[model samples]
Target chain A: MSGYWAGILSILAINIIFAYGIFIPVASGQLNLGGAGFQAVGAYSAGWLSASFGLPVSVTIAFGVIVTGVIGVLIAFPILRTKGVYLVLATFAFAEVIAGAILSSEPLGGAMGISVPGYIDWYVSVIFAGLVTVFVFYLMATRFGLTIRAIHDDEDVSDLMGVSVRNVKVAAFGIGAALTGLSGGLYAHSFSYIEIQGFNALVSIYVLLYVLLGGTQTAWGPLVGATFFTLLPEALRSVLPATKNFLVTLFGETGIVAPPDESWRFVILGALTVLMMVFRPEGLVTRTMVERLQFWRPANRGVTQ
Target chain B: MLLLQQFVNSIMLGSVYVTVAVAFTLTIGILNFLNFTIPTLFMIAGMMGWALSYYGLPLGLSGPLPWPIALMGAVVLTIIASLIVERFTFRYLKTKYGDSTEHAIPLVSSLGFLLVLENLVRIGYGTDSRRFEGPDADLTMNIGGIFVRVPQLVSLAVTVVIVLGLTMMIKHSRIGRGLRAIAENPDAANILGVDTRRIVPVVFILTGLLCGLAGALFAINYGEVSPAMGEDIGTKAIAGMVIGGLGSIWGAVLGGLIVGLIEMMTVHFFGADTVQVMVWGALLLTLLAYPSGLLGHNTIGKGKL
Candidate 1:
């Protein structure tokens, strides 16, 4: 593969894993906005372990996943106490705190960032992404997933129906964190470097957007969302300049014919997000849409279930 | 005396935070929606003001206007942008499914707007920071051996007056009563004769006014404007909003000031690198330990997303 394609594939794989990490919590009715924090914990832990202790890649990645999972569970208890906007704010604050802590810690290399010794190629991350996708799908098919869905539908009613809302939420959050950590570890190894700036609030927001816009209904959502959004910029890279050239040709000569800015990609994404919410707030791949595709039942076209 | 000067400086910084925090708190408080575009709105005012003053109106409409006029034009543009955001996000909030994550639609759309507006600005104006040619921000006054920037003092007073005015308007005006009713219960207020659509736009208007004013003040005080300016101040404002407790104006005020104080003190003692850690750490602690905040009502922001 060309270097460009390889780079794109690696990013696509990492984003898919990261999206699922966020997807697990959102599916369980929790908006884990501090995704970058968990991912950072995973990446930095793996980086530090490899750089400082010279641990093997496998062990360090495992350590990263476990440590991030544990921290997620620890943070989940207190954070889950607040619901809705407070919950979102709490998670955001948690990420900022993690970033802040990472940036200031000396052994972690602070703002200088740490470099990992162990390196991995694109295939490794792709394999991990595939595994995580299957795992999440399997998870969603189990009784535990049913309980999470129940809790997501209505917490109090689920509680009345004998569901342990708190435990399920914490479990989902932890699993999501672990998955996000795994992706981060892969990112560090794949890129061969890790920095705090790479995992800022914007990354969290983008990952969450992938999950939310993809459809939180099923595991398919994140897969589709991640792939589409990840490739979108690459697609636009050629399209934007061509469109600008076309405009310039059509308009002859004018000051308005300035070269297209790279930021147009984000602008397009943002516009799509706004339009999607207006026309299809439920997301692009919803439960009903998935069901219709599977069953091919014309009568069930508009029926939700 | 140096500590005292730091304290005063913190207050000046806090004034900006307080304005933005109130803008954030107001939306969350009344509409029960966390508008992510707020920071973008703030940035718009500053960047637009700079653009207008430095380059005049786009397309040679006129020569560069005076700074104050430019700021006024920027504030007006920001209000229009806020209204545009409201039309898209808030207006389309309702979903037929009514699932737990239904509330996230507006939030997600606002995130889209955040990305769109901010990046559009980046495209229109280059990514680099520009010097804002405003009144001399260095004019200082010495009182008891403590130095205070004259512009900072004026801006601080303006912030105080605006907050007081907003509080009084929310407390005593008919519109305020309607807003309070809507905040208490949107459907109930609608049933009782409050125009949900009309009153909702009012919140966005106020949000734009507050954010624009804050952004203008920041430009004058800091003497620089940039596309990325909002991310730092916006996140800090969010921390202030949470620390003060979501949905409480007074809580936001206290929270903004507390955040400013923490930021200045951290810079004084631990260097600027640790400020993020301290401010975010304080926010995380507040969310975990006292979600209701100092002056916030416990019920606000607890609604399921």
Candidate 2:
């Protein structure tokens, strides 16, 4: 594959992993706007481990995931105490704190950022993404995932049914954090550089948007959401200028038409998000939709959801 | 004396946060939805104002306009944009799934708008910060050994007046009653003859007005405007809103001021790099220790996700 395709694929892989990282918490009905913070922790951990100790890529990436997972567990106790909008804001604040601490810590290179000593090929990340996708699918099929969905549907009812709401939320949050960290570690190794700026609040917002747009009802949501959005800009790159040229030619305007604005992709994304929420607030996919796709399996339809 | 100067400057800075935070608290309080496009609306006013004054209207429709007129035009544009946001986000919020993320429909849509609007502004105007040509920003007054910028003082006064007026309207006006009814229960409010369709837009209008005014004041006081300016201010305002407690206007005012002071002090004592950590850390702590915030109603946002 060409470098361009490799670059896009690598990014897509990382984003898919990251999107699932967020999808776990969101799937349980928590809006984790602090995704970038957890990601930064993971990235910095790998970057620091490789740079400081000359660690191998696997070791550093593993260390990154473990450390972020531990941090997630520690933070989740207090964070899960809040709900709804407050929960969202708390996560957002947590991410900002992480970014800020990294930015100010001299050992982390402060604002200068850090370059990783370890490097990984795009295929490594792609493989990781595939494994993660399978893992999430397996997870959603389990009893724990059922409880999570139960809690998501109605917390009071879930609690009344004897589900440990706190434990489930915390576990989901920690696991989500770990996955996000893994993605970050891969990102560090793939790019060979890490910067606090890349993990700003907007990153968190974008990831959350991906998951939400995908539909939090099932494991497929993040995959579809992330894939569509990550590739949308590339699709627009080819399509927008042509459409602009077509319009210009059709109008026979004498003035020079500027190339299509790069912002149109996001505008379309925003518009789609709005329309989707209005028309199909369950997201691009639904349990029924998934069931219908498996039309031959009428026996399995009763179990879906 | 130096300390006193920082305090005065902090108050001036806090006024901007106060305005934005109030807008935030208002939406969360009334609609139970965290309106993410608020910052975008704020930016729209500032960037559009700058564009109107520097580059004239879109597509060569007109030459550079006067500063005040430009600001007015910007506010109008923001209000219109806000109404559009309401159409996409608020109007179609009720979802069929009745799942955990149902509450997030509007919030997610708002995030969509946030990306769309902010990027569109970036595409229309370059991403660089530009000096806003307003009435002389240099005008200052000496008060008890501290120098205060006249524009900042005026802006602060304006914020106070607006807040007080808003409080009165919410407390006494028929519209205020309608809004409160909706906040208590949208269905009951509708049953009681409150115009859900009509009054919901009022919240957006108020949100637009507050954000627009804050953006204008920020431009006049700081003498700089950028497409990205709102992100920082908006986040800080969120910190303020949380500190003061969501759904409490007075709390937002106090929270905004306190955050402003904390930010200035962090900058003064710990250097600029630590402000993010300090502010966000404070927010995290608050979310843990006092999830309801300093003055937040215990019942607000306490429901399941």
- In order, the Cα lDDT scores of the candidates are 0.92, 0.91
The C-alpha stretches of model 1 lying farther than 4 A from their native spots are: A253-259, A295-305
Per-prediction share of native contacts kept: 0.85, 0.88
- Expressed as tens digits, the lDDT of each residue in B1-305 for candidate 2 is 88888998899889999999999999999989888899889999998888899988888999999999999998999899999999988886676656678878888888888988898888877789999999966787887778988888889999999999999999999999999999999999999999999999999999999999999888888889998899999999999999999899999999999999999999999899899999889888898899888999978876533
Question: Which lDDT value does model 1 have at A17?
Answer: 97
- Residue-level lDDT of model 2, residues A1-305, one tens digit each, is 99899889999999999999999998888989999999999999999999999989999999999999999999999888888888998999999998899989999999999999888889999999999999999999999999889988888899999999999999999999999999999999999999899999889988988898888898999999999999999999999988998988898876677787788888898888878878888878777789778748766445866
Pairs that clash in candidate 2 = none
Per-structure clash totals for the candidates:
0, 0
lDDT of 1 by residue, A1-305 (tens): 88889899999999999999999999988888999999999999999999999988999999999999999999889988888988898899889989999998999989889889999889989999999999999999999999988988889999999998999999999999999999999998889898899999999999999998999988899999999999999999988888888878787865555557888989988999999899988778988788868845667556799
Q: Is the docking of candidate 1 incorrect, acceptable, medium or high quality?
A: high
The TM-score, computed over Cα atoms with residue i paired to residue i, of candidate 2 is: 0.97
Off by over 4 Å in 2: A251-258, A298-305, B57-62
RMSD of 2: 2.0
RMSD of each: 2.3, 2.0
